[model samples]
Target chain A: MQVATFLAYLVAAVLFITGIRRLRKPGTARSGNTIAAFGMVIALVATFLVVEVDAAWVWLLIGVGILLGGVLGAASAQMVPMTAMPQMVAAFNGVGGGCIALVALSEFYQGAAETWVAVISGLLTVVIGSVSFAGSIVAFTKLQELAFTGSVVFPLQQVLNALIFVGILLLSANVLADGAIVEAVGAPFLSPLVSLYILFAASLVLGVLFVIPIGGADMPIVISLLNAFTGLAAAASGFVLGNYALLIGGTLVGASGTILTRLMSGALGRPLGKIIFAGITATATQKGDQQEDREVHDASPGEVGEYLSEEANKIVIVPGYGLAVAQAQGPMHDLMETLESRGKEVLFGIHPVAGRMPGHMNVLLTEAGVPYDKLYDLEDINPEFDDTDAAIIVGANDVVNPAANDPEQDTPISGMPILEVEKAKRVIFVKRSLSPGFAGVDNPLFYDTEKTMMLFSDAKQGLQEVVEAVKSA
Target chain B: MEQLLVQLAIFIIAAFLGFELISRVPNLLHTPLMSATNAIHGIVLVGAIIVFATADDTFTIVVGFIAIVLGAMNVIGGFWVTNRMLGMFRPPVKRVRKRKG
Candidate 1:
């Protein structure tokens, strides 16, 4: 039975690797998911078989928990739209953290931490798991569009975060030291429960503060960070429980989440640490005087369509988060097809942080039946924007801003890489209004009359009208 | 210390293995890949099941119950949602399946 259980775990681990590998391509990704789910089922069944349980109430609790989880899980997946996938991901990952924290706490109650290794691991789980849970909840809220999605900055926010980090470490060190040496002296060394609770509370507070000032578009970074935290926490839970599956599985998640974080931050033309530590949006508003406003010409969709119907070498469409919200990808694709049919070369240029999630615009455009080859990432397409005849920006602001290109001013997004749509001979912005983007910085591209024009309308409406006008022209 | 060594070995091996495994995913499939990995990590459910099954006290039972609930939810919701998102990425020809009206 022992050998069989270990074999099951081993198989599950292999399957997880296989699943992730197959997820690279659209053709095999679905099967990869199924295989991984099967592995999970086997791991779970083996775990239940190996653990000795005779009590009927415990069995009852386990059954009830599974039933409740199954119902809620199915309901959420069926109900939550893909647009809300970010929030759902945040919320579910948060639950994983909360669950792991509970596992650590319960093991502590069961005296599983009799050894120093176990004691330290248990405390680590409690701290990291609590933070992941709290941070994920904040990320979920920021993405859910429930209320304000803007940054909530305050005086000395970094100082407060540092203080909280120090507080968490001091509390954790005290608990572990008490469990290790002070217990030998036998003077009611420490209430493990009290210290654990206080530690969890402080970590939870830190998680909130850590994510509170982050704006909506940056939630992807926070979600990735929290996901990594939960992974390490789960591994720590493994140490508490002496379970190899938990340890291995959790570490895999931690490492992968970390890699994804670096990839996402790089895509946005910022370092991972900068996105997390510096609330650039908050500070940029304080130094907003540099953007001297200039009047922009308002062009009708008919005029833009006439321009597209005319002789143009190349046109690039840059879609951002607003494209997702407006459900305009389909019409945008129609416009692209129309443009192509009229003997014009049309391509898409995507900024790394163009959408709320990593690969947000890519997945969205692909779902709208756009081919992979036409969609060029920032580096590949940045040079082409200058040679292009026109660049139509659909409800995006900061990614195309010239501010990122200008390094002398030291603006919040100064070092960030942006789509040089302004370099195009003629640029058109399709937006509902002239509002500042999530970065809260003015985009000079919208105000430049010689090279830029604003099509002040909904993305879908603008695209549809433009497509119709092109057909008529 | 020996036990911790095994744990550390498992940790490093899994990290390298995961990085190698997931690095090939195309940018277009990133959303699905993320959701899929999220489901894979929901393997935490196994730990919750073990804890809940072995727990003795009422408080432990309560904690185990909550953990199991959350773990199961994470696994189920994550996999289902990932599948739904990936379902949207079918090629143009086969994207439209026949509907029984």
Candidate 2:
């Protein structure tokens, strides 16, 4: 039995590693997911075999849980739109954290409490799991558009949080000391119930306070950070349960989440702290500054196509959620291929938080078989916009909006990070209509005159037509 | 050995089915699922505490107490945090004012 359990654990660990590796590449993500699921199956089987539960009622409870959870999980995936995927990821992480925490609690209850080690492990699980659960829920709500995703600062919010955290530590010492005193004095220890409740409350409040200051624009970073928190909680729970497989899995998740957070922060040209605490939007506004009016350019789709074929030195494609909604990746890839064949320098400008999730644009582009190297994050490609002959904005709105820098816009999205597409010599926007973005703000870039063209149609169909036109040319 | 293998298989299969089913739900249902699970954890905590307070065996009693506390923390902490986070996602309502010339 032990040998089989070890073998299963080994297999599961290998699968997890492979799945994580495959997750880095967009083409293999689905396969990676399947592999991870398979690993989880092995782990679950091993766990059931090793854990002793004598009660028949326990088995019945487990059966009920499985049935209930299964139904709920299936319903979520089918109903959630791609636009709300980030929130979904956050919610899933919370579930994972909650599961591990429960497992730890079960283990603690089944073990001898005399061991200081077990008590410490239980405490660790409570702290980390509580934080992860609360933090992830906050992240999910923000991503779901159900609540404000921006920074909310009450005076001394950080200071108050720190004080509360200190209070939790003090309470923890009392609990631990009481346990020791009971053993030393041959008396019953005070119930840890009060301390547990207090600790849990403090951690929960801290999680919300920690995430509330993070703005919507930095959701990718927040999501990554919360993922790391979940991983840490899982690892702590694994320790409490003395589960090797759990430890390995949790460590991997924690490490990956941290690395992803750092990479995202770097991509946004900001530190992790700033990403977490900076309430500034992608575009920053200055006080007492008048909105500058610039000459605006407008052109028909055909004329823009002609300009691309005739005079553009280089072209950069900016894709957004609209591209995903319209299923335009295939057509866009074909258009890029045509442009490259014409000896045009074509690159893609990918914003960090473009679309609903981090790397969403990159995932779509990679699915279309666009070379990984050609995809440039905002910081990497911002400088190139100046020398580029034409910037093709496709289905993207807030990221490419010039109003991010326009001081007088008074829009909620003003002072947020946005691609400086206007800096490009010629700008062409492809859209079905002049609809506002998710934030419901009009983009002044639509009216930019230096060299602007509006190609009206669904992104997929428009790109297909452009591909054909370029092919014929 | 065969019985153990069978049990393991059953557990794995059930877990897989459960995960697959849960993953398919809509966004709105996630919180409700979490809330329900939290309630279960609370029940588990209460059961553990009762066992600990009444059990004759010292080791079992100690273990039960630990489990109870940890389970309680999970239940209370999870729900409290989720609610606070949900608060952040609420959209601001605009107030309309009458024009006074």
Candidate 3:
């Protein structure tokens, strides 16, 4: 029976690895997901059969628990729209953290061996799991609009978090040292169970503090970081329980989530340390030395169509959060098709940090049935923008801002990489107003008089007008 | 000590494996991959199940039940949502061309 359980976990791990590899491309992502889910089913069935249970009530409770949970998860997954995916993912991840935290609690209470291994594992699991659970809730709330999406500040937020961090460490050490090493710590001033509860509460508060100060723009990284935390916690619980499946699965999650977090932080051109510790909110102070207002050239949709229609020239489309907000993907696709039909080469220039979350624009474009080949990532498309005849901007503000290129003014997004649309021969901008984007910084490209033109309209309306104007011209 | 060391070896290898596997995925699929990994980590439900099946007293039963429920939610919700998100990424169905049928 022990051999069978270990073999099953090994098989499951192989499946998970293959599944991840298959998810690398658009063609195999769905199949990869199926493979991973199949592995999960195998792991689940194996767990149920091997885990010794004497009580029938426990079985009943498990059935009811699983049935209830499965229904809720399925309903929400089916119903949540594409735009709300980030928060939905966050909420589910939060539940996973909460689940492991409770498992750790049960292990601690059971007091199997009370060995140093068990004690340390339980303490680590409880702390990390609680932190992830609470932090994920904050992420979900912010992304889902249950709370404000901007950074929340108080006096010495970082200092407060640090103090709590120290307290959690002290409590954790007490759990380890007093329980095993020291015979009696001053006549047992604090009970182990009560001290654990206190530690749990403290970690929960720490999780909230950890996420609350970070804003919506950094949510993808935050979510990835929390997912990694939950994974590490789950792995720690595995140590307490001595379960191979938990150990392997949890470690896989921890490592992948961390890599993705690092990738996303690099895409944002911000250090991971600054994002987490400094809490670089959208409200960061901007130096006044670089403020300049130039004459704005507002163009018409008719003019945009006419420009796009100009004889067989290449054009690049840059989509951002505004495109998602305006629901302009379908129209954007229509425009792409229209330009393609006219023998003009149209390529999509996708910035890594274009939308609210990682791959936010790609998902929208894919949903709209945009071909995978036409999409070019930042590195590939940035150079091509210089050779293109026209660059069309729809609703995105900061991702396409040339201000990122300017060295003079130290704006919040100063060092971040941006879509070099300003390099295109003619720039057609579409927007409702001259409002700053999520970064809360004005785009220098807009105020430029050289070749940039703004349509000054809603995204969907602007795109539709351009399509109409193109058809007529 | 030996047992813990074995578990540590298993953990280190798994982490390295995860890092290697996740790096292969493209930026375009990051969100879907994120959701999918979210589902994969739902393996914690297995841990919850262990807690539930072996629960002895009232405290164990109560905490174990909560673990099962939350774990089940993560497993079910994470996989369901991931599949749903991935569903949006599929290619449009193409009509087969008739060969003089």
Candidate 4:
């Protein structure tokens, strides 16, 4: 029986690794997810059969838990709109972190960790897991706009976080010392349980403090980092239980997440430490307000459509989170089709960090039935804009902002790579206002009257009107 | 102590494998890749089951039960959402071609 259980775990780990390997390409990604879920089914069933249960009610409780969780998770996953994916992913990650924390707590309550290694691992799991849990919940709220999406920094915020972190460390040490005392004397005088709960509470607070100061623009990196933390916490729990499947599976995700976090921050031209420690300050917001009075060129969607149909032969569309917010993907697709039908060549210049998450714009465009061949990456499309007829920016600002290239300006997005949309024959922006993007830096591209035209409207209505005008012209 | 050494070796090797596997992925599939990995870590449900099965006290049992539920949700939701996202990446239908021709 023991041999069979270990064999099953070995097989499950192989399947998971295979699935992740297959996920490298678009063609195999769906099958990869299915393969990984199949591995999970095997691991779950083996767990149910191998675990020795003494209470009949425990079986009933476990059954009910799986059923309820399955129904809720499936319904939400099936129904959530693609635009809300970041928050949905955050919520799911939060619950996973919560589960690891609870497992560590239950292990502590049952006195299941008999060795020093298990004790240390259990403590580490509780701290990391709770931090991930609370931090992910904060991330969910920020992405959902349920709370203030800007960086929230009180006076001495960093100092307060440091103090809470130190407190958690000291409380964890006290628990370890209490456990030692209990082992030596065989009697519990000062219980470790009290110190353990205190450690958990402090870690939760530390998690909240860690995430609250990060602005909405940096959510992708933050979520990736927390996902890594949860993975490490699960591995720690595996040490407590001597479970090979948990150890292998959790470490795989931890490594993958760490790499992704690095890649995301690198794409934004920000160091991971800078994003985490010195949050983008209030200076960027103040800078945007200083330019509020500057007059800029504005045009109607009809004029822009006329320009596209009459003058532009080649067009490039740049999309951002606002396009998703306005639910304009369908309309944007319609406009693309209209241009194509009129014998205009249209392509998409997709920035790496164009939307709320990595590859977010690609998924949204693809969902609107855009062909795979129409989308081009920043490196692939930047040179194309130089001789292009028009660069129509749909609800995007930062990626097209020229300030990123100016060495004299030291803004939050300085030195970041941006689309060279300004170099096109004509620039058109479909935006509601001259407001800054998530990084809070006002774009100078909107003010270039000779080369740019701004149509101030919601992205959906703006794109729909453009489509109608193009059809008529 | 011996078991600890073996587990540590496995952990190190798996971490390296993960890094190598994910490093090659292109920018287009990143969100789904993240979501898929998020689901893979849901194997924490195994640990939750062990805790729940052995609990002799009400507090431990209650905590274990919640852990199991949350872990199940994480596993189910992570994979399901990933599948949904990947399902959106279908090639533009043949109608666009027919219309153009």
Candidate 5:
């Protein structure tokens, strides 16, 4: 039995490593997921071998958890638009934290109530889990556009939080010291309860403080950080449970989450500390105020198609959340193919946070089988926009907004990085309506007369029409 | 043997369901799901710590302590790495082009 448990844990660890590796590239991600899942199944089987429980009840619990999780997960996946993916991530993180806390609670109940170590572990689990759960929920709400995402500040907020944090640490220290003495005296309950209560309060406050200062722009990093936190908490719980597989699995998750968070922060060009404390709102006005120019080029779809066919020597396609919303990846791919066949130089410019989630645009494009080489990150592609004959901006708003350039805009997105679509000789925009982006500000780029045309339609439909127009032409 | 088979079946089914759910979700949800799973592992940590601190056997206690340290390291290290990764996306300061007189 011991050997079997070890083997199962080893297998699970291997699978996890492979899954993480596969996740780095688009082509093998699904296979990696399957492999990891298989390993988890092995780990679960191995866990049952060590921990004997009522067979009927364990089965029932597993069934119920699966059924509930499946139903909820499926419903959310189907109902959520691609734009709300960040929010969904937050909600999922919260759920994970809640589950960990619950598991810790159960473990505590099973242990000797007087055991200080168990009590400390339980306290840690509950505090971290609760904060992650609540904080993630807030993040989800913000990303979903269902709640106010701006920083909520009261005077001395930081000071108050600091005090609470210190208090909790002090309480933890006292409990640890007292627990050792109490165990010697055979009186463990008193110290542990006090520690648990203090830890819980401190964690809750910490969660709020952690999230309150983060604006919507930093959500991707926040989600990644929370993910790491949850992984660590899981590893901690694994220690408490004395489960080798859990420890390995949890450690892998925690490590990966941290790596992803760093990658996300790097993508935003912000330090982690600045992101956590900057508290800047994501107002759309960052693009300098919309210059009053009614001289916007009003090209019909047919006219735009003609211009695209005639003058575009090198065309760059910039996709946004609008593309995902319209499910237009297939049509976009077809359009790219048509352009390529016609000897037009075509490539895609991908903003890190272009779509609802980080790398969403890349994922959607990859699914459509766009060549990896054709996709370029912002830094590599920004300079090429100037020389390109035409730049097609699809379903993207704030990323292309000129307000990022205007110093006086005073908007939260001011000084933030953006794609220089305005520099392109000819600019074409595909959008459903003039609805503002996450920053809720109108784009002045839409009104630019310098060869800018708005192809107002659903992204998928718009791309499909363009494909047909190109074919006929 | 029958009980083991039953448990295995249950485990497989649960894992399959989890996989299916994960597949349908957008990329953004992946991190959150991972976070939630990590939290569940925290419970496992608490359990091990309790067993280690209270168990009469010296071997069990020693093993538990080692596991606890490793687990704590994993959590702390993971968060630190995540913080570093998120620093990647800060917008670069635009260089002012100096005009030659």
Candidate 6:
């Protein structure tokens, strides 16, 4: 039975790897998700078979837990709109982190830390798991705009976090020292178990501190980083229990999540270290206030639509988080169709970090029944803007901000790769105000009257009006 | 010690295999890939069960039970949402299957 159980775990790990392998392509990604879920089922059944439950009440508890969790999980997964997928992922990831932390705490309760390996790994799990849990909850709230959507910072913020880290290390060291000398002394000043509880609490606080300073616009990288932390915590718990399935599955997520974090930060044109440490504080640079008073060309949606319908032959649409906030994807799709019917070439230029997460805009656009090929990636569409007649930007600012290219200006988004929309013959911005983006950097493109126009309105309403004007024209 | 050595070996190899598996996912599938891997790590459910079954005291039992519930939610919700997100990415042709043969 032991051998059979281990074999089942190995088979489940193989299936998980195969599923991720299949996830590399769009055609097979859905089946890949199904395959991974199947692996989870196998591992789950094998776990139930091997665990020796002597009490009938424990069985009832287990059954009820699974049933309740399944119903809630399935309900939310089905009901959550695609626009809210980032927060949904964060919520689920938080639960997983919390679950792992509890597992570590329970292991300590069972006195499984007799050996040195067990003591270290168990403590590691408690720290990382608790941090991941608390951090993920904070991330979810930020993305959901529940309490505080902007970055929170004060003087000596990083110093306070550093002091807390040192304190946790000192406490953990005492725990390890207590474990080492307990058999000899018979009683120690501080019980290792008590130290662990303190460590867990401190780690949770550290997690909140770690995420609260990161701005909401940087939530994608933060989410990916927290996801990786949870994976590592799970692997550490696997070490505590000597479980093969947990080790393999956790390591897979840990590695992939780390790589994904790097990729996301790279796409946003920021180094991973800078993003984690400095964060985008949105300090409201001096350029923002002065730009408001500058002369600008603001056009009505009808005039802009007439330009697209009559003057422009090839057009590109750039989308941002504002599009998601205004729920404008549907209306935007109507505008796309209208432009296409006019014998104009219309393609979507999707910056990798355009929305709240990587590929976020792509998912929203695809959900609105836009053809897959109609969307082009950043690298694929950057050069095409030069020959394009007009670029229609909907609620996107920083991603297309010309400041990223100006070597003279030292803005928060300086040196970040932008869409180069100013290269197009004409640029029209549909936005609520001349305000800067989440990064708090003013856009020179909005002020270029010779080729740029602003249609001031909500994203959905502006798109609707533009569609009507284009149709009538 | 030998068992620990074996587990460590498995961990390193799995880490390498993971990096290789998702090294080059296209931007189109990044969200689904993150969601899928998120579900895979929900394998912590197995660990939760192991702890719960062996727990003797009330504190341990309560902690273990909550862990089980959270793990189950993570597993179910992660995979279900990934599937839904991936379902939105259809090919260029619209409703091709609706035509009669």
**Best prediction by DockQ:** 6
TM-score of chain A of 4: 0.95
lDDT for position A288 in model 5: 34
CA shift of A143, model 5, Å: 2.6
lDDT by residue for model 3 (A275-388), tens:
886453435565434344557998999888988897439999998888888889999999998988888888999888777677878888878888766778888899998789
Model 5: per-residue Cα lDDT over A1-473, one tens digit each: 38887787777777766755554544454455455556655665676566554346444444444444545544554455444555665665666666565456444444432455545655677767768877887788777667756656666776777787786766665565764544554545456545555566677778867787677767778877887677666665655555556566666666666656666666655568777765332223344354453555766667667777887889999998778777888889899989888989998988877775566566567657676557788888899998998899888888888876788666555666788988889899988876767666567788777668988888888888887777777
CA lDDT of each prediction against the hidden true structure: 0.80, 0.60, 0.83, 0.87, 0.62, 0.87
Which pairs clash (backbone N, Cα, C closer than 3 Å) in model 1?
A: none
Off by over 4 Å in 1: A155-163, A177-190, A279-284, A290-293, B22-25, B92-101
Contacts from the true interface found in each model, as a fraction, amount to 0.68, 0.01, 0.80, 0.75, 0.06, 0.80
> Could you give candidate 6's per-residue lDDT for residues A290-319 as a string of tens digits?
554787898998899899999999999999
Q: Is candidate 1 or candidate 2 better by lDDT?
A: 1
State residue A55's C-alpha deviation in candidate 5, in Å. 6.5
Worst 10 residues of 5 chain A by lDDT: A279-288
> What fraction of the real A-B contacts shows up in model 6?
0.80
Cand. 4 Cα-lDDT: 0.87
Per-prediction TM-score, please? 0.91, 0.67, 0.94, 0.95, 0.72, 0.95
- DockQ for every model comes to 0.58, 0.03, 0.69, 0.76, 0.06, 0.80
lDDT agreement of model 1 with the native: 0.80
To one decimal, what is the Cα RMSD in angstroms of model 5 from the true structure? 11.7
Locate the minimum summed-lDDT window of 10 residues in model 1 chain A: A278-287
TM-score of 2: 0.67
Backbone clashes (count) for model 5: 50
Model 1, residue A316: C-alpha shift (Å): 1.8
Per-residue lDDT of model 4, residues A169-285, tens digit only:
766666778646534555445468877888889889888888988888888888888998889899889889999888988998899889988877877777899888854343334
